[model samples]
Target: IGSRFSADTFRIRDFFAMNRVNFTWIDIESDPQVDELLKQLQISEGDTPVVAFGNEWIRRNPTNRELAERLGILSTLKEEVYDLAIVGAGPAGLAAAVYGASEGLSTVVLDRKAPGGQAGTSSNIENYPGFPMGLSGRELAGRMTLQAQKFGAQLSTPREVVKLEFENGYPVLYLDHDKCVSAKCLLIATGASYRRLNAEGREQFEGVGVYYDATPIEAELCGGSLVVVVGGANSAGQATVFLAEHARKVLLLLRGDDWGKDMSRYLSRRIEQTKNIELLTNTEITRMTGNGHLETIEIRNNRTGETRMVETRAVFTFIGAVPHTEWLPEGIETDEKGFIKTGSTVMNSPLWTAQRRPHFLETSRSGVFAAGDVRAGSMKRVASAVGEGAMAVAFVHEYLKEM
Candidate 1:
């Protein structure tokens, strides 16, 4: 009964579903047993989201780290050091951990949030290999996490690595909460985040009508309202398809002339075939207007120079990706767009004074590497990220031998 109005319930449900956490929801409005239990726990009907894990019961929705701690998966790092430290739990980091631990190296993988990164939030990954039927991004990431841990790689979540520096010959990282750790080698595989719209009033409607991701958490908030999805990539197409299930109408705004130019053939066909999905090419959002929540958006046609306002509460963007390299040290060279420089490309850097050229996927800093979307000139695909991560482990072995 309260599901429609409660964003917290949808968030909790979506997070659990994505992480593959086994848990049940009790409405308490219908079940007498659950109602009585809620009464016992002093959780009234107004408090709809009372999550229980093991012996602990949280009155409010739990964050990802809190859930991990309750489930006994978040490991305590303490003062323990490692042979290799990965600063992201996306595909690249997970692959490195799986390979690093299986090859007898002590590895620790840390992520600021949950393990899946951006790819984990996807509803269905049809293009990824071995999954013809298209399993969820969460399932793939959860399986990889388990495989990494199965080989003895330690994972710590919701832990942010604020800064990195070189201490002696090893790399040292300072994380949030005054925690310091060191590793012989480091991998900056934080990947990329969803780029935000540069239109006016875009910030005011965030979390209200505009969202970067169209996962169920955001979809549930739209509540059959007319939705507008920006960008023409596969991620935007996926969001459009997923949002169409709940949104009354889905409008895809493409700044380019051809819809299929950036999107996958399959997704383009699906968007073209969908009845409720409207495709507007050479379009761009000029402004967003609302009292507190986004009520309308003004769009411009780049080709025709015509402008019009549309009624839409939800706007999802899946445009270009910007790498997460701000926290990286100065020695680790990055492109103008902040993607880490790797392989022979590092040879162009003045920092590359070593006798041997940098190994493929190795960053400008010796013993430091990069892969996935975070690496400069990398192919933005899950398979390529996995391949680079596994390949980086081989170079790690060679670097260690020289050490």
Candidate 2:
């Protein structure tokens, strides 16, 4: 018998344990005698491993990759139209979907790429609550997606929203190639994008040797090789710590003298104790050189006017992120940095003050709301995003009721 829970089976465990193989194991072995019993029953060949699900032969020595593809577990088709249309399938959007659908509102979530915005790119998130052991950003996003879908939230991936407009007091969302979707309400959960270095050859070597976010796919390319990470904030510090675990050496290049003071103290201490990491202050990448892939990065020391070349297989940058709101209408109130602005009062609150007024998460344009990293004054965290998303929905209800 085969199980789809544990990885105690030697063959299946070894196949996934090898980093070279890009496959995930989902099952475990039940009993050695079961294999022989199946052969005796003329159901399977005794020479190879076999799986039986209720007297039916499901597989024979099948690799996990093959099983995943055959079972349609890799990808599935998505439906269109929803009562509540959510743009950006990150944490905020997923949270809203769960609450909206569970509350009997038809919800639809769309994303330009895979779910889990900037937070998904993280290798491990230790600060999130409820998990003392810590969890990967990918895992957290996956759980949220499952929870949302369980409550009837529809998800559409690899779809981009091109424009947003209002028709008869209802918000209409437009996708690439003029695909339009009208909804009772719209939530701008479209998170932010990382700012690129714009160095020569940086574009050409994007997937081959350069990456904006440190993920498992990018980390695998740095096996036993030197890696360069550029940034000074929490993201940079996190990347340096994550890369240092797999790479032979990690060079952290900061534009200033010290790590961003806002970085968590525990993370700062870990980076200091890690012997494999090298800290370079007041430095910047001047250029990059490679034919098909990146071989060496040229750095400029701002203080000494000196240049140095660091040979490495891969470079990960986490400098900062830019909000994705260019398509939004100009009438919508936003901060100087382009983040959506909300009123300084809680929705449906009876208390009001002239100076210390309550602000709801309503965007400059009435009836439109912003949440998560896309909203101004938002605390960039998974838990915080969920809270903001739920609160925004309450405001949306109030906005519609008054209108």
All-Cα superposition RMSD per candidate: 3.3, 9.8
Candidate 2: residue 300 Cα off by (Å): 1.3
Per-residue CA lDDT of candidate 1, range 130-228, in tens?
989886667789999999999999998777899998888889889988888799999889999878888999987766677677776677566668999
Q: How well does model 2 score by local distance difference test?
A: 0.71
User: Which parts of model 1 have CA positions greater than 4 angstroms off?
Assistant: 1-18, 22-56, 59-67
Best by TM-score: 1
Evaluate residue 320 in candidate 1 and report its C-alpha lDDT on the 0 to 100 scale: 85
lDDT of 2 by residue, 1-403 (tens): 3332222233343323221224433222435575557556565433334543445546666765454445343243334445677888788888888888888878888786556777777778887889887787777888888898899987765567888887787788888645677777788998887789867667766665677778655675677999999887777777889999899999988877866576778778888999999989899888888766688889999899899888986888887668999988765666778787767633223322223332377665566778899888888777899888788777767655655
In candidate 1 the C-alpha lDDT for residue 346 amounts to 86
Error of 2 at 292 (Å): 0.8
What are the TM-scores, per candidate, against the unseen true structure? 0.88, 0.77
